[model samples]
Target: MVLEAAVLYVKPGLEKAYESAFQQASAIISSMKGYRSHELQRCLEVKGKYLLLVEWESLEDHTIGFRQSVEYQDWKQLLHHFYEPFPVVEHFEKVDLT
Candidate 1:
């Protein structure tokens, strides 16, 4: 599995709206190939900061498939504007657990 993580810094007072947007926009990615699941988490220390985690069967499903699809355009329209600055997305692979 591939884990995609992003740190979203929403503008102040836009947390609820952003979260709602995410809830709706999540469907776009969910419909794509190799999609597994996703989670959105709010930060306790930072009021409008959120953590977005998406699981995919492989990195190509996200980096190539999802990005090239029309659904990604809608995904950007729905949720990208809510962030103050664009979030940086990174991927990881599970190695081991203790």
Candidate 2:
């Protein structure tokens, strides 16, 4: 599985609003092809900070299948404006130690 990670820096006073918007946006991503799971974590020490992690079957599943889909637009509209400088998204694979 591919793991997509992003550190979201929300606009200061809009943190609560962003969380609420994320709730609606989550449904859009969960319904997409190759979607495994996703989580949004709020930082305890930092205000207006969050970490977003999403699991996909492959990199293409997110880079192409989801990003290029019509549903992504809805996802963007709902949550994109909350970011200040925009978050950078990256993907990774599991590093087995056993």
Over 4 Å off in model 2, which ranges?
none
Tens digit of lDDT per residue, candidate 2, span 14-41? 9889999999899999999999999999
Give the per-residue Cα lDDT of candidate 1 at 27. 81
Model 1 regions lying over 4 Å from their true place:
none
Cα lDDT, all candidates: 0.93, 0.96
Flag clash pairs in model 1: none
Among all candidates shown, the one with the greatest TM-score = 2
Candidate 2 minimal-lDDT segment of 10 residues = 76-85
- Give the per-residue lDDT of model 1 (tens digit) for 37-61: 9999999998999999999999999
Q: What C-alpha lDDT, on a 0 to 100 scale, does residue 41 get in candidate 2?
A: 100
Best candidate according to lDDT = 2
Q: Compute the lDDT for candidate 2.
A: 0.96
